[model samples]
Target: MAHRLLVCRIWTLSAKEIRCLPASSTAIASTSFSTSLQPSSSQVSFLSPSHGLPRSFTHTTRRQVSFNVQDNEDFTERVINSQLPVLIDFHAQWCGPCKILGPRLEKAVAKQKGRVAMAKVDIDDHTDLAIEYGVSAVPTVIAMRGGDVVDHFVGIKDDDELDSFVSKVIGK
Candidate 1:
C-alpha cells in the first residue's frame, strides 16, 4: 500500500542529508558473509556534534527550555485545551530527523515569545497519543487551534520553512 511505503520512507535517511553532517573517517571491520566482492574491513565514521556527547554533559548548562508532555492526560489538558495555539512535535528518541527538527521548532516557538506554545511528545513513550493524531513517523509537527488540528508537516524542514510554518500557525 502507498501508506505503508510512506511510513517506511520516513525512517530512511537520504545520502544528501547524511552528507550534511561532518564526519571523520575510521576503519571498521566488515561483518558481511559474501564471497564474490568483499573487503575484510571498511572505513567508516560519522559525527553528529550532539550525538557524540553525553546527554547530561549537554544539558548541564542549557536552560530548562523544553515543553515535553508528560503523558496522555497532560497532552489532553495542555495541548487540546490550551488558549494559545499549540505546536505539537511528535518525535522518537531513535529518529534522526527528530533530532534535526527539535531545536529548530523550539527556536521558532521562542521567537513567538508566548504568542504560541509548543509541546513535545516522544512517540515511544506516548504511542496512544501518536496513534490518536495519526502520526506514522517521527518529527511530525501538528498545529492546533481551539482544540482542532489546523496545520501540520512531516520531515526536517529548514529554518526558513520552520519560521514560516510557525508564523502561519500563529497567524502572524
Candidate 2:
C-alpha cells in the first residue's frame, strides 16, 4: 500500500502541468531555469507550458545613493566637481572592517536624501585615489565640499555614530 501511494504521488507530479505566473506586473522580469530535485522555500519553479522546463522569476529594484569610483578621471569628474558634498569611502575588498562599514556609510548617506553623495574607492582597484587622499588604511571616509577635504575618519562606526558623522559632514 505504501509503495502504491509513493508511485501515485510521483505519477501525479509528473502528469501535472505547472505554469509560471508573474508575481506582479510592475516587477522587472529576468529569466532563469532550475534543475534541482527540491526547491527551497524562498524559490518557486514551474514548468513552462511551451518549453516543458522549470522556470524561475525574481524582481529587484533599489534607489541609488552612492556610486563606485572607476578611475582618477571619474573621481575628479564626479566627486571633486559635484555641487553637493561628497563622501569618499576609501576601502579594500579584502578588509573586513571595510565590508562592515560600507553599508553603514551608505545608509547614513541615504538618510540625507540628495544632500550628499558617496564615492566608493577600492584601494586595490584605485590605489592612486587612495594614495592621493592619504589613505594608508581600509575604511577611511572623507567628506569634501567645493573641491576641498572638510572632514574624515578611519575604522568602523556604529549606526548612530555614522548618522552623526554624515550630519556633521553636511554641516547640519
Give the best candidate by TM-score.
2
lDDT against the true structure, per candidate, is 0.75, 0.78
Question: Roughly what TM-score does model 2 have, to 2 decimal places?
Answer: 0.65
lDDT of 2 by residue, 54-139 (tens): 33346666679999998888988999999999999998889999989999999999999889999999999988787888998889
Stretches of candidate 2 above 4 Å error?
A: 1-61
Q: TM-score of each candidate?
A: 0.62, 0.65
lDDT agreement of model 2 with the native: 0.78
Off by over 4 Å in 1: 1-65
Candidate with top lDDT is: 2
